[model samples]
Target: MRSGASRLDLLAARDARHALLVRHAGAGHPALVAVALNVPGEEKSPPGAEPLFRWALDQVIAALPGAWPLHVGDDALGPFALLASRAEAGGAKTACVAVEASHPAARLVDLDVYAPGGTVVDRAALGLPPRRCLLCEAAAGECIRLGRHPLDAVVARARALLADAPA
Candidate 1:
């Protein structure tokens, strides 16, 4: 895994239980950080995501049930603004935390439901693949056995356009 991915793992481990509040209404959406699927620096994302990155936040929102009130961009940072709008639309009040990860699109389903403050899980969160780098079975086996944490890699990235943009 890349250094960023490793960092993401650490964060996931730390915040696996904490739900970054995005769109809360009495009980807004809470999510975990998993950015293993996203690009580093988020060259594809808006300015903030390109540098800061909030992969899990976006992922969690996508995984949520009801349609959000605001529009979310395919790029990063849009999620935050969208979530804020959704919260108001839902008529619920809650604090939302912006999440970031090196692995883009990584998320934890029902994070707040599982652990409100935050929880520590095993290596499965690390996002180890089934194989060992296509050549190293040992490494792969270790990853499966140890299971790495998934949060350390990503930091929240917001878009400049959305930074000032309202929900």
Candidate 2:
């Protein structure tokens, strides 16, 4: 299958897993994390994405006190997976947002903390800065809004950044 189709399939599977987790957890919150890439093309699982994802996950585990390893999906989709854990004090959404804000690769990681009722925790409510663009220091939303850079340029910049990241 083409990479785009494969990505959709992976996403669908991830959603199913999330639903299952919700059903099983009853009232527990869900922490969902995935790798985010700048460009969309044939290369979905870029060179450094898996390592970066793993590293980010490790950081999340360390930050969330009393975290438990529940389900770890395959790295077929560049380390896309979910961690079902309950923190000691703050809710799961708080813990997930904390990890997103503090991770070194915050630009390349998409971490969402979901409430037990399935609502996502608002990053804006937490007062986190807008995500920066992969190619430029500008806000990512602004760059995409203005089409400030070509896809190739952004992809190249992201690749270079990943290259420098320790595997």
Candidate 3:
């Protein structure tokens, strides 16, 4: 079994492979959607991670009409690799942000949308607000950029959020 830290590395490699697959498929703009977690230790794939990821993917699929799935990989790394053919990357990203915002486990789970080139699609480009901190109302980016909170605190809050999620 891969350690949680190594799982992240594996996820990066998988992402590169998916990008190549997207290019080979001749899709104008493919979207790679996955879960984002605020894990503190070497336990990236927590208990509810996969379930939350699947729920988020379902929402994205519903929002993006006519999106054809090109690839689907459910791994132990808690990264749900979903590549879909979409007309506009921005639209797909917007839908993903909406799902993240509406989900009960929104704080603990993140639905990230990546463009064909392997770069993450920005939520701001789609007129979405910056992601809020898992523990507070501050922007998540700011907290991360400044290392404002202890890792343990963030992780605990994430666990609590996951615990409160609907079964």
Clashing pairs in 3: none
Local accuracy by lDDT, each model:
0.30, 0.59, 0.64
Instruction: Report each candidate's C-alpha RMSD, comma-separated, in the order given.
Output: 12.4, 3.7, 3.4
- Candidate 2: give the clashing pairs: none
| Model 2 error, position 64 (Å) | 0.4
Q: Compared with the true structure, what per-residue lDDT tens digits does model 2 show for residues 53-141? A: 67767777777755655565543244555655665223555666665566445456676655555555556656667667776788888
Better of 1 and 2 by TM-score: 2
Q: What is candidate 1's lDDT per residue for 53-135, written digit by digit as tens?
A: 24344444554434243322232211222232233221221122122212222221112211122232223344423222212
* lDDT minimum window of 10 residues, candidate 3: 74-83
Residue-pair clashes per prediction, in order, are 39, 0, 0
Q: Runs in model 2 with CA error above 4 Å?
A: 1-27, 30-40, 75-77, 88-104
- How much is the lDDT of residue 25 in candidate 2? 53
| Clash tally for model 2 | 0
Model 3: per-residue lDDT, tens digit, 1-167?
A: 13644765767756765565556444455665554444444566677666666666566678887665555554434455455646466777777677677865865556566676666678777767888888789998899899999988987877776766644
TM-score of model 1 vs. true structure: 0.23
Candidate with top TM-score is: 3
Give candidate 1 misplaced runs (Cα > 4 Å): 1-57, 66-114, 121-167
Runs in model 3 deviating more than 4 A are 1-26, 30-40, 74-77, 114-120
Each candidate structure's TM-score, on Cα atoms with residue i matched to residue i, is: 0.23, 0.72, 0.75
Q: lDDT: which is higher, 2 or 3?
A: 3
